[model samples]
Target chain A: MNESLRNIWTILKRELTGYFASPVAYVFIVIFLLLNGFFTFMLGGFFELGEASLSRPFFNWHPWLYLFLVPAAGMRLWAEERRVGTLELLLTMPVTAAQAIIGKFLACWAFLALALALTFPVVGSVYYLGHPDGGAIFAGYVGSLLLAGSYLAVTVATSAITRNQVISFILSVVICFFLILAGWEPVTSLMVRWAPAGLVELVTGFSVMPHFASFQRGVIDFRDLLFFASVIVFSLFGTSVILRGLRGA
Target chain B: MIDVENLIKEFGPKRAVNGVSFTIRRGEILGFLGPNGAGKSTTMRMITGFFPPTSGRVRIGGHDIAEEPIAAKKLIGYLPESAPCYSDMTVNGFLRFTAELRGMRGAQIDAAVAKVAGLCFLEGVLHQSVDTLSKGYRHRTCFAQSILHDPEVLVLDEPTDGLDPNQKHEVRQIIKRMGQTKAIIFSTHILEEVEACCSRAIIIDRGTVVANGTPAELKARAETAGSVHLRVRNVAAETLKSKLGSLPVAGRVSLQDNPDGSLSARVFPRDKSTRADLSLSVAQTATQSGWSFDELHTEEGRLDDVFRAITLPDSVKNRE
Candidate 1:
């Protein structure tokens, strides 16, 4: 168990350092912060909600924002290794596949947290202006994190399938978009109208909306947490399988 | 110690390594000599556990590569061809990461990194990013990473492929020193490198082992079908040709006119014969006819000749 933790730490440290050592992480943080702020205030019309709270404005656009920006952060996690022939070196190292996948995913997730943290001004502004439910604000951030983690997990799995960064990014975004849209009321209603009742329920359960909705409402449900955790675990497991197949090949 | 038994690797219909097997004892430097596409890299990859063989098994230090890959890999240090490394990391950072991945911690990691850095002459470039370094320095950094953990078995594929002559010499010297305590398997297309560095060589061609022996043994095999080149002066071409033709050792003698009024004759011997007998016959003829023997030297067969002779298409088909 100690050795496994050490391996995780080693992979995490190397991945985080790789991010900061290059211009990629900084560029991602700056672009994500700028876009999030721009869409929340100017485009999302936070004042129109009229509650002097960022709950609606900030949390409303996070799904769409992560749909694009998260791929940028997560696309190179495994794809670049395959591209540069370093995947062989990494896989042949004395670490379990799960350790490598988790370590890399957590490092990128930490970068996302850093980017979210820089949006503190938005939270601070909401606090400074008027009365708002602090619990809701906290829950909103949790939901965003879970949502980001889920997307990154999927992206990491897709990245492991190919060496081309562009293809990984595009495929991840499309897949995440589908998952997000599948949970939207209009899409689920349409599926319910046309498809069998059981299939509609399954599709709705698979989407990010129902689970994210609980967190958005300032409630941390066990089922919702399990939903996100299971997604992360299952996707990483798939990534490991793909990598093992590559090594076997 | 390393043992590969009946290892086979196939890519679709193309057989990359076919029932290939070999063994390397401790403290021996075995050179894997072959041309391009001769399955040398494929075989090394299998032994290093980067890829599993389609069949058979590899045992490194008594640990089966397939059954106990981590244990086997722990005993081996591998440097793949072209020495690919991360370009973003500094030399020190890369080495440290590699050491950590190999399960070293704290002072052990530091000491291992320092030892390898010094061994590969990477002290000056330790802080510099790998992308900014020259090719020789990059190769050295990769070399340093490979030996950072001091494994008992070392596999280097084309270790000196891109270095200049001076750099090649330096790397060869380092390898020779390291071979004292480790079993080293290095592959290269340069036969001169084998002659200079390897105690034994395994020559492969067309995805199969063609010959395996010491450099001297291979040279001796080539000498059995040797040809001689001679330069004689002041002798009529017909007389010299007839004299060489009459010798028992000379199978086929052909004379050519030289620019300096000397006649050069090439003598093919049916069996392995020393140059003394051919020299004696030419010397006797020159002494009796007042001719001059400018040059009478026995041709020593080289590794290149052996490689060419053994890997020829006709010879390969005949071996089957």
Candidate 2:
């Protein structure tokens, strides 16, 4: 493998193992599964709907679910390194800045991907009860992952800006909360007149729920994929910039 | 070899390292000596390519650190002051990870890990998590990681800080051993450590190099260097001063009364080059006069004295 890719893999290996070694991993995975189950069955009324569709119960709530869950995982991404002073150790190594950021960010994304995979039972239930649309379900999983990617990027970027994980978590949640809010129809419709048309369109287009809504219905639009990819790229780039600034500071 | 030329680091309005420059060759242990916040850490950081120098160049072998950091950093093994590492990792695991990061793998990684672990006396704690280890072991683990790949240049920031006497002695011994092959620089404010392990020492104050030379050369700069200390019995202070003053020695001779009713006198030489045989002459004088003496010796001076004199503020120095 090339040097950059090798460095990324090394960081990823450490981070993933770090999660499993700590109590936080068990806590996060358990809470993630429990809350996912509760929201899908009790709140979203999967049984009352009595349909094979996992959209309303599963994919529909991914944006809201990831708003809090993704940051919980991503808060420690850079904040822990800063608090423990390993950022200096890492930056001093032969690895470049991009490798460190991508390695760490991808590790958290992979952990979230594992957490999402645990929800396979939901898919099983939908399949057993009725012959559900595998194509749509696959698309939903892809979109849900893309949604989680966007949120993780936000958390990692914010975490890089500060040493305190609490501040990193809170800042990420607040930013995510607004981004999701812009997608909700009622809130945006009311503000459409008061807000400028272009500003409204930009917020609406950038909002997580709207971009994710198409995937919730298994549409697989290129525009939505583009949105999520752009967010991830821009946030990781910002993390590198912030890290460089800290070194000089 | 490591060469730093005109290295400067400015943190906002404050200059942390100012126009510092030095060169270190293989088998030479360079002691970086300074007080707290005196830019020793900052200078080391720039040399290791951890932080870029604002307006200078650091060349490791032939590669410039800023222009080719990856190539330069590959030749370095750095242990930052606190010895930072993943607290969650086992000692073996962290060492393996660091070895791999430096491009070691498989049996080579294991061999390097075992070598440094043994050299650093970390064999006992290899299985334990880093957070669970004692401060001494945590420090040793970091030291071991630095030497895992055995890079050409070793930069350690206060490698012996917070270690017990035994641990400090062991660490010094390892640095001395490694000094045979690597261009090593270890920073410390402990005056004796420079004399203990370093062949050449650089003393910095307020971001600038104040004195740089061999330990002997620096010690020679002290006011007490090459002075004669004579302890005599059955002699009054006035008699001893008048007698010693009559000698060919052309500087002040002061006497202090000792607790045993003997007189202790310190004699300065006429010039910076005090004769190495001054103590012999003083002994001859005491014997010829039949004056019994407790002790007589020539002082080579201590690095402690040299460090204080060289690093002291100009105002305080001038007042004395």
Candidate 3:
């Protein structure tokens, strides 16, 4: 491997293992599975709807599910390093700031992917009840992973702004919640009163739901993939900018 | 080699390090001394490329820090103040991580880690978590990481701050041993440390270099450089003070308590006295006066006194 590639891999491997060394990995996986099962079966009315489709009962709940879990996973990423003063030690190494950011974000993304994978039983049950759309289920997993990446990126950037994990978590959730509300019908309709049509469209265009809606029925679009990729790239850039802005602070 | 020129660091309107410059050649151990907030750690941070200087430049082995930070940083092994490490990691794990970051790989990483761990005496705590180690062990663990890649330059900030006496001695020995091939700079408030290991010392006060020279040169800069101390059994301090006061070799005689029920007097030379032979005169006078002498010796001037004068000149001048 290239040296920088090796370094990033080393950091990613350590960070991923670090999550498991603590109870964080098990706790996050168990809670995520439980929440997905409860909300899918009880709230989404899978029985009453009598549909074998997992979209409404399982995959549809990802945005809200990630709203809480992504920030929880990312809150400590930078905040804990700053608070403990290890940020200085880490930065002084041969690694570049961008490399550190990429390495850590990849770790959290991989951990969230692990949590997402553990929900495979949902797909199994949906298949048992009725012949579910296999392509749709796979696409749902893909879209859901992209959604988790966007949330994690935002949380990682927010965590870089402060040294308090609680503050980082709250700041990320508030920012992410605003992003979620941008395309919600009630909020956009209320905004349609005073807002220009073009501006409202642009605002909602950045929302996760509009982009995430395509993969609900196994439809894969380049635009939705671009949106998630842009979110990840923009947020990672913001994280590095915030880190540079606070140098010698 | 480590070269720093006109380094200035500004935090808002306050200048933490103002236009400081110095150089350290290989085989030299430079001791950085100052009072609290004198910018010792700030200077070290800049040297290690942890913090960019507001102005000026640092060049490690001819590579400019700002222009070529990675190249400069690759040559530096730094131990920041408080010895910050990943507390959750075992000593062995942290060492391996640092070694890999320093570009060591495969069997080289393992060999390098073992070399530094053994040199720092961290073999005993290799399996222990960093947070579980005592202050001394934690300090050595950090020291081990800094040397894992065997960088050409080492910057240590208060490496022995909270260690016990034995630990301090051991750390000093390690630094002395390393000084032969590595250009090293370490900061400390402990004056005796300069004497223990440093080949040269720099005293920084209010973000400026007040004095920079060999350790002995700094001690000689003290105003009482050639003073001699005499502990007499039965002579009155007044009599010795008058007699020593009149001697041409002696300038002023001040009495000090020896804590052993003996009257101790310090004799200062008249002028430019660092190289003067005042002890010979004091001993001759003691023999002629028939005063029973318990102890008599010439003082080389205490580094603490010199440190106080250089780093805290305002208070020292006010007291005088």
Which candidate tops TM-score?
A: 2
Question: In candidate 2, what are the lDDT values of residues B65-177, reduced to their tens digit?
Answer: 88898999899999998898899999999999888789887999889999999999999989999999988899889888888888899999999988899999999998998
In model 1, how large is the Cα lDDT of residue B259? 87
The fraction of reference interface contacts (C-alpha pairs within 8 A across chains A and B) present in each candidate is 0.57, 0.68, 0.59
TM-score list, all predictions: 0.93, 0.97, 0.96
Provide the interface RMSD of candidate 3 in angstroms, 1 decimal place: 1.6
- The deviation in Å at residue B107 for candidate 3 is 1.8
Off by over 4 Å in 1: B223-226, B256-259, B272-291, B312-320
lDDT of 1 by residue, B111-168 (tens): 9988888877889999999989998898888878778888899999888978888879
Cα lDDT tens digits for candidate 3, A119-185: 8888888888998789988888999999999999999999999999999999999988877889877
Docking quality level of the chain pair in candidate 2? medium
Instruction: Give the better candidate number (2 or 3) by TM-score.
Output: 2
Better of 1 and 2 by DockQ: 2
Per lDDT, the best of the predicted structures is: 2
TM-score of predicted chain B versus true chain B for each candidate:
0.89, 0.96, 0.94
Q: What tens digits encode model 3's per-residue C-alpha lDDT throughout B268-287?
A: 88776523678888889999
Each candidate's lDDT (Cα)? Answer: 0.85, 0.89, 0.88
In the range A1-249, model 2's lDDT, one tens digit per residue, is: 888899999999999999999998889989999999999999989889888998988787788888898999999889998898788788888999899999999998999999999999999999998988888898899999998999999999999999999999999999999889987988898988799999888888768888788888888999889999999999999998899888893
